[model samples]
Target: MSINKFIKASIQEEDQEPSAPSPQAESFSDFDRAYHSMLCAGCSCLCDDISYYMKEGHVTRTLNLCEVGWKRLCAVSAEDRVPPPSPSLLSDTVNQAARLLQAHPPVLVLGADNADEAAIRTSFELAGTFRGISLPWAYPGIRRFYERAKRFGWATGLLDEVRDRAESVIFWRADPLVTHHRHLSRYSLFARGRLTERGNLDRNLAAVASHETVIEPLCQQFFQLSTDQDSALIEALAHPGGGGGLDHRDLPALARALQGSSYVALFVDPEKVTYEALDAMFRWSAKLNTEGRKRMVILPLWDAGPNIEGFCRVSLEKNATPWGGPFAKASAGTQPEDTSWEDLAGTVGSVILISSGVDASPGNVLPKGLSEKPRVVIDPFKRTPALKDQVVIPTALPGLESDGIFFRADGLPFDVHGIEVWRNHGYPTVRDVLADLMSEGR
Candidate 1:
């Protein structure tokens, strides 16, 4: 069958499903209700094709949204996802984020994976310029993989690109349906890409699942692994030669399955795959390339707040180091004398927290480097109160209340627009705050 006919048939299948027209919003004049691009960062699908139906003021109906997106758009409240943070509590945090690092810039800047990448880069350049630390964020693992990417090459392409170019997709410890609902529909499977032409040709998709999942049902091939079996697979993949300096035969099925592709796409969840496991997975991808696959691409899955991709790029520039760079290292930013948050709070003079999506309480902490001093926070929300000298300056929510370029897990650009559904004591961006702090010289 022709590629065009195959694509048409796919469309026909979608057309058969019940559908509704998007609400006509030609009359609403409210700024918040105005037409804006709706891209939910709640998950990795990073679905960019969202539109909203405005009622009195806020979104009454978010068109084409999935469950996660629907939950975010809807006012369904949860303890962890909806606790209103107080600036006062955060205001009471240690001032080390500013003061200690002010004397000698920090080297390692971790946690860029949690926030928007553009802002993170601002933080990175600040670190690098100040000679602050940047490396291995959140944990000690994954640095080698990052270093490898930096050395061999780190190529970034978007989900849209995958839909357009990918012929074979291999999901390693990744379930886009769970992690990113509608990904298969909007971007991967049901998506209409330019190359989807050759009919169901050799366009293969495979997934590794804990149980029969939404992914397993849809993939052309499935690898079911118990926790133990999964670990064994990782071990086998990592060693290739199976620990005893010989290739193990247990992975023959996986090896043979992988053999049947020209171009392949590999996706893995960073949280699930350890460094060694990830190394093995990459080795397999590399092997596929040498074995005559036309192309090879890898997509790393990361879980964080939002816009982690933009922050990574920004952090890399500011710190001369990537996000997850070392925060304890002197080269990243050294504050050896700075007291820990536990020791400095209440006793130390005051505090400041330049943060977003953080708990605003005494226990709600900053890094050891930032918690020792008294300071102020440049925030974008209203949260809990402080224990001592505290001030919470509200800021805007990236992509929601503010406009910027956000990045995906694969480090591709995602243009964002505002979507303010609630009250926020908005403050300036972190970059602006740093500029102000320097200008004031306080």
Candidate 2:
């Protein structure tokens, strides 16, 4: 297919720091099938128009897939997708997986933004099983927004809602086109939606981000921003002049646009927005008194890790934390600090890795130094950076192999699974394996 078609069919994905094997020669055989339309929620692109080609639990070819999607599909394994099956000790591996939870009191499970729903559920099950903290590693900009949202319960809508009914859509620190590929085609620029049957110049797309980006022709306005989801505008709003800070040259224009917008929708990843900025937005939204023509919606451009939201919902419903891993919430005295993989070095005990998605091989996130302790990997591809594990359990990639639902960036529910593969129930979901491990009671 042409690159444009491939791009359209692509699923936008964030960078997964792990290293893994190259696409397999025998990855897809004769038995697998292809799936279309379903999107991967690993990133904000939320490209729903995607296609996958698979063969017998493996992906052979892909259409309309992004780099991340192709990598994710290619990473699937049909057979026992685990580590090297070390020492003939399944029991020990299981025990270690559970014990890691038990020992790491108030475990803070991170990096679930790119994971599928099944994996997310498994993580939550583990958390509940162990009672730990599970925080989905979404964009840091939205942290303030999420925090305020948890308290005041802000209003929200979907991408389509903005494209259809909203007069304005503010994409803060995010580019859906480059990352999402089909977002413009499906919802924003050239596409059609509920109120916009013949989408052309009906809705406005405002990009507030760092660096010069490509959607030049379609955007109504552009605001140069920091790559690190900055909230200088909010600070400016609070302290308009007592100011000795960054200059927001076009901020006045942005605020004017918002004030003039009859129906406004802010599409942002809460991780990028600051507490003050988000609070200001919230206050502004409340004052707008959205009733009919003057409506506002705030869509948190969320990206689910394997099971981040799924696990979070389950954790809340079940009142359980994700893992017993070290976290600030559960720890009595010590707090879990954000340490890069480089700093983790030799402190890591037995490693239990689950190559969650197509983003990258989890090895990149592991410390460069070896732990010497036995390693356990859960994935289908035998060759990858996570390859050093003493045991390899080939686990099936969930979306194509099994069926389940995952939430979108706006917390709206969507299905992640499709008939992309032809698989018998022999290969179980990661949740089942973790469930068995948790059952053994570490």
Candidate 3:
């Protein structure tokens, strides 16, 4: 079915569900009332202006949610949802998981990218307790970029800042329309901001990608180049008059556009380019700023789940590193290192998979040996063809069925309240489950 049809059907289905008075509902004359400022856990954008019209406990209608957010809400009642395990069974499973971690010297806690701030912190604590390692299921390129930023300072600003003051914006192999559905309307291109009072008209927009994208037509400049040409193109832009040995006709014009603007924001998806290309992009932006030519910043653009930033932040605070460690304890002061899928498969002794709504599944990308390791899966939905000898614990969907703190793509924190009561579903939050394991260990 088409996306629109599917969304329409999902909305219709939600509207048809019977409603009952919820204990949490506020006193209202009307049966249906709208709750505003609800955060959407669809992607890293975390659009916080969502409004849900609730009839008693059920969400009868919604406002400000994009197709991706609508699908996320639909998933709360998806037919394939895993039935909640009984409390006794849950206790037993937690005990078993604790025992497994205790036996495995270095437990690999994966999938923090999709978890809430509290759960992510708890995951690190759990890892520290068991002399384990915690890492987000993010692209290697992103990890590399973060590492590079520590060595050579990164020039970045918040998305709100980009929306307010940016005179020129370039989408460098990043397509927000597809990944972050509301990004253009809410934070970039079309949003009316302080200095950009005329919105798109007042700002210059450019896009660079390997293939055609939906955003290309909206951009004033679009560079469609081969995957290998990104480094050369960036080099050309970094040194405008030098040509940098590239023959792109638009290179001069693009450089001129950037140089002419007072404030420039370069949004890039690290996954779309190699480490060298990403580094060059950052350096180019830095050079532009240092030379006093323009106020330039390179903002990373990737769907690294909802709270990858939260995980990195927590890791930095607790481990003195953003994304690597089998530290014996929290705040061990270990230098951060990037962990690849191959390294994980070969090094980690055991696994604790925190499968939140995002696609945290290793799928076919991970080595077979990683799957063979003793594993514990905490997820809201049931896995097809369940793994052998692995414990699967059902959990509440973050930002939808549970209340917690989540960070946006720009490192801004949002206190997300659950739109639906989680207890009604008999599932615990990821934090609760991890806390249980920690208690079991004690």
Candidate 4:
């Protein structure tokens, strides 16, 4: 089959059962709220101020959740095919997985950015035991910013701090209007901070993107610049008086506003940005701190799978850097080589994929041979595995079915409480499966 057709079929199969639209709040006056305060796991923000109404053990309506998140919460009643585990069969499966790990000298363990810390760490232990390479599934788009912050400590804090203290918020190559639906209303423009009680009236909002977004109306200044011109804009900001452009007479004024702000926060999105552009942003933030005596905090608008932050945190502690496969070290006897995604197929003998309720398909980056390898997939949903001869183990959803700790985009740990209603359902968590695998090896 063609790749396009396969992708289309996979998507169609994934969304086999569309959820029913939820009613308005006015229609639910008499319905008692069961899960009144809930945490949303849809986006990386992990918005915790959710009001969920339950009818007969299933979530019916959610208040204060964004449209995307509301739909995820409403999917609790979908015909999710989760089977009860049979001990004999599960043991046989785990033994088969363990044997695969033992046989494949340097297996590449991937995915689990959306899993809890426990699961992420357990997978690491499993890999370490077998001397295999473990890597994050999602690439860290804000790695440059993260590295800069760690190397040269930046004056930064959590989302609440940004909402309360920042006087000027600049979106550099970022469109929170799409990635984070409630970013403007909940944290920046419409949110009345402690000092800026007048909300957007008391703050300056600036954006630099290729095209306009829904949040353009709230922007104090919008610079419609091409991707190739990001460095030029940064250069102009660095030297505002140079007037390096023939168009947009307001560039100097915007630069002045950024320089003059008492407290400024820069929200960067690197989805379309290059490394040079990242370097310019780092330099821009550094210059702002050095020259003005006021520090500018750079926040990213990128969201990863649930526990990518946790994986990064652990990776930083152990490896002094956070990255996805294929990572390699200096020598064979030394740590494994810090590998890139492009180098995986040429190196590894086998692959162990963890689906984590998201995309389970092998990405196009994998070589055809590795892509065709018989593998193991751990996921909550019961969709067909991308590989033909793959072992599919059903697990429980993190926030809805299982309780664990997950970090927000800014690295703040949020506690997730699993529904007690799902405890008796006999579904396993990523941690459970990994732990059992590790235990089997011992």
Instruction: Please write out the lDDT profile of model 1 over residues 1-442, one tens digit for every residue.
Output: 5545655654554333223333364444532463445776655456676776565555645555666556544422223332433554333322334454454333234343434555554544544544543332322223444554665454445777777777767677778766666666665566657886542444666777677865665566676764435556644533444542333343555445445544556776655655555555556556555655356777765544455555555545644444444445442243222323343232223333444343333225565544544445555434435534344444555555555666665666777665555324243544544444333333
Using TM-score as the measure, the top candidate is: 3
Tens digit of per-residue lDDT, candidate 2, span 22-74: 34543544436767777664444556766555555555455555555555554
lDDT top scorer: 3
Candidate 2 residue-wise lDDT at 365: 49
lDDT of 4 at 303: 45
TM-score ranking, high to low = 3, 4, 2, 1
* Candidate 4 positional error at 5, Å: 39
Segments in model 3 whose C-alpha atoms lie over 4 Å from true places = 1-31, 103-105, 326-339, 356-367, 382-384, 420-423
Scored against the true structure, residue 439 in model 3 reaches a CA lDDT of: 88
In candidate 4, what are the lDDT values of residues 1-442, reduced to their tens digit? 5534543443343222234344543465545446767886666677787766666666655567766565555444446554657877777888887776666656666776668878877877777666666676445464555655666656556888788878888888777666666676667665788987877667788888888765565566788888888888878876777634525756767777877777788887755676677777777777777887776887766645656667777766666667543255211332222334445555665677776443334445345756755566776755543455566677777787888888877788888877677656677788889888778666
Question: Which ten residues in a row are the worst by lDDT in model 2?
Answer: 11-20
Estimate candidate 4's alpha-carbon lDDT, on a 0 to 1 scale. Answer: 0.67
Indicate the residue-level lDDT of 55 in model 4: 63
lDDT of 3 at 416: 82
Give each model's whole-structure lDDT.
0.51, 0.53, 0.75, 0.67
Q: How far out, in Å, is residue 438 in model 3?
A: 2.3
After superposing all C-alphas onto the true structure, candidate 1 shows an RMSD in angstroms of: 8.0
* Residue 144's lDDT in candidate 3: 72
